[model samples]
Target: MNLFTDIRTLVIASLDAMVADGALPDGLDFANVAVEPPRDAAHGDMATNAAMVLAKPAKQKPRDIAEKLAEKLAMDDRITSAEVAGPGFLNLRLAPGIWQDVIGSVLAAGTDFGRSDVGQGKKVNVEYVSANPTGPLHVGHTRGAVFGDALASLLDFAGFNVTREYYINDGGAQVDVLARSVYLRYLEAHGQEVAFEDGTYPGDYLIAVGEDLKTRVGDAYVGQPESVWLEKIRDYATEAMMDLIRADLASLGVVMDKFYSEKSLYGTGRIEAALDSLESKGLIYEGVLEPPKGKKPEDWEPREQTLFKSTEHGDDVDRPVKKSDGAWTYFAPDIAYHYDKVTRGYDLLIDIFGADHGGYVKRMKAAVSALSDGTVPLDIKLTQLVKLFKNGEPFKMSKRAGTFVTLRDVVDQVGPDVTRFVMLTRKNDAPLDFDFDKVLEQSKDNPVFYVQYANARVCSALRKATEVGLDVSDAATAAADLSLITDPAQLSVAKKLAEWPRLIEIAARTNEPHRVAFYLYELASDLHGLYHLGKDNADLRFIDEGNSAATQAKMALARAVSVVISAGLGILGVTPVEEMR
Candidate 1:
């Protein structure tokens, strides 16, 4: 079904034949040989660097090898012509039937057309949006949530066993602040006026938790000491905040398979166990790290503490696992958490962090590497800031003004589909400007609407064909004589369709979900272009009005495009529109 993979197989087989004919050396490495679309579509449908990669290795000139390879490739039925372009690049023009088959294959496969097995079922743990469970998720957390969810879906489509995870930072100082904030709210619930000091959370979202606490305990700890109420309120408040956070994630269509509590690593021997594993490898030591370069904290001085030899594994400096006060540093719990993931037998680990955590990247990777002994790899993706725009003007977020945008605020405004798609339009490391006016605009510039419009138009075509008594059922399209689709415009769509399987592998390998967004935009463009062309050419229309065979052929293409759009949107977690409202 993957025409590119099939064509590459033929190319490799021809190269083997060349080896047999003594035109190339025996047992030459072919891993670098690649079959990809040429930069210019007019140059060819596909091109290979086999000749260029093998030329110097085989002790032959590139053109000399390309000429011999061309002679061998011309014998294949799929490749109509193989021309040696500049610097021995072999550009191939595939037979038109190859493009024809791509359409039929798409129709046959339905929405499952581009699902790939390149991952071979390796277990991948993608941890994202691990924001502190202290308050409602803000706009900053929304970007990480969308990126991680899309990445998990993309990896799943590429055949990786994906586990969507959220690491709850409940064991941090922020949760204590949350506890005190809720306590103040609780006092207010008891008819006491309270002031939200500089350190306390002033958002109205905590009022409910405070009232619920009053209902549960009914004045039991009304004027007690900190010891009596702090622990109970901290636990209750943390759970409530987590419940609210989960709902916020649910609003965006994100569901995590795991929610790891940072508190769990505190009471148990988990931190010690992770450190012991590192100690056994001589990566743990009692040492003092030099103060950071340039502007060191004035209070910072040489202090021997529990340190991880992260420098050996490529960190800028050896990092402390324990503070001078003997408590575990924040890095300690993180190291143990990733160690637990490695021990759970995942083949790979991916962490989606906010851009501010860029400084934590190297040491985190070093810790995971030391824990796993480099057996498992960790890829940390840092999601940059999302700037909001309203009416083409920069939108402001003010915590003191109590006008901070929550994830719920965004989903309520645009709905989850538009939220997810627009969030992914930019690369994770690149800053994104999410303009409210532009996203809802029903134009090509609005990718979410444009892609959805393509799906809606396909549905319109099918409904019209049905009205004209054409057999446009899934069963009929699957059984249609797809060979009748011979127009150059029709085949151009199928050629774009052929790139899906390859696109999935590339996007997954690069951990870049923006590629999927870009690809869907291109596919939607092709579908819309083909639909607009039918306005002038009656033969290109999906509903022929008289000839059932021609109508089936056109509907087959339209249906195929809709199927691919649905599949791509599924990866993006967007529901395809059946009709535009």
Candidate 2:
């Protein structure tokens, strides 16, 4: 159960009672009232801002409202004390039995203890890691992949219907470059001496694709020009690169529910349909776009072209949808793609892009806004660069040298769990340092290890208790008499456990997966602290040599911690460790 939400409900109910008794005026706005953890744990278990928010509206001072609200809240059995702090902030200390019951609730819920229904089953489409099909995914895309996957999982946990998507950018000049590069390799497969052009890919990853093409069609077009073989090899090579990209994502535990192709939008009437929707709204026009301010191209002459009135929807200026040669520009396909998403009846859209695409955010948002008439909202998250380090030096990567750090490289060294956890230890828009030497260390400084160790400790406690003939199974813990768990240290862990459901809601609302990482770290810290306390105090241990009642109560607490940890790790797409090696 969410104790914070329950306490907020009580706060609102008491405010209604005040209105009924004329202690507070009728129609007083209480929308801003909030119940949350106190800034300082020493202040109390929970704090509310009801008095401060309603004081001015009710034409009363904050302290006066707090005093009356405190008296009314004190009548509830769950709240032991409600004391006013500075400027009438109400700090609440809960009854001991309430925290005691949280342990039993956690054990009953198991790994689903913290799952929330805050999303209300809204359809959320998350698009991410649309890396170009030119090469293998590098260290930078790894961060976005991990962040986006974890975020999708977090939203799913909070009750959103999440769809993970990848957009294949196969309709660009980069694909032409890829085609030429594969042709060079194709000639090499036929034993011809060929050199990779300056604009072509030279990575050894594509050599196998060239060899495979020979295997499939033995010596069919060995000496042909670009006209006979370019289109065939382009399609073949793009598929190979996508397979490589998919494998890279699989290594990091990222699986896309859908893969959308840019080339498909070319032949379909989707682009025209999206533009026609904009045209009906008077957002499309024929005009000449001014050269970008402060930077002009050599071909800077004004030319007639089709444009979208993006400025009306908050873009700096109208953007060109068609080039002077009458072919669709890059922005055209993007507009059409988002329009397709809106037509598919998604309630919301989220795109995870790299920081370099920061300038593209406003235009994309404007497209979705204009397309859906503000009915569908789009949220774009840009993940910043990741700097890999080893022994305090900037690590170097070169695909041509076959020494690049792929997603597989990182996951192979530390495994997917460590790679995913360490990638999310920072905010998405901030630079993250993935140090090879530091992350694998078995110490508190390594957050992944620390969190895993907490789960392992709980497993160890259950094993020890079982060895001593204590009933510590899920059925046993669920039916345990939890009132015997009265120690302050034990209750502290229960209080943390009570915050899990609230944590999931907040993290999902803000679309911040790093908050989940931070919460897991704090929860792990509390679990570890309680475990260490058992060393000096025999009564705090999970197993009591002669008392089954006490043993069951303590096992309930330990199992409860494991339950919450497993839930948090599930959201992160990391499996909890049964034992630490």
Q: Give all candidates' CA lDDT scores.
A: 0.90, 0.90
Residue-wise lDDT of candidate 1 within 126-203, one digit each (tens)? 999998888889888999999999999999999999999999999988888889998998998999899989688898
**Residue by residue across 85-138, what tens digits does model 2's lDDT show?**
999999999999999989877877778887889989999999999998987888
Clash number for candidate 1: 0
Give the lowest summed-lDDT range of ten residues in model 1.
Answer: 395-404
lDDT of 2: 0.90
TM-score of each: 0.98, 0.97
In model 1, the clashing pairs are none
Counted clashes in each candidate structure: 0, 0
- After superposition, candidate 2 runs with Cα above 4 Å error: 295-299, 398-404
Q: How much is the lDDT of residue 487 in candidate 1?
A: 81
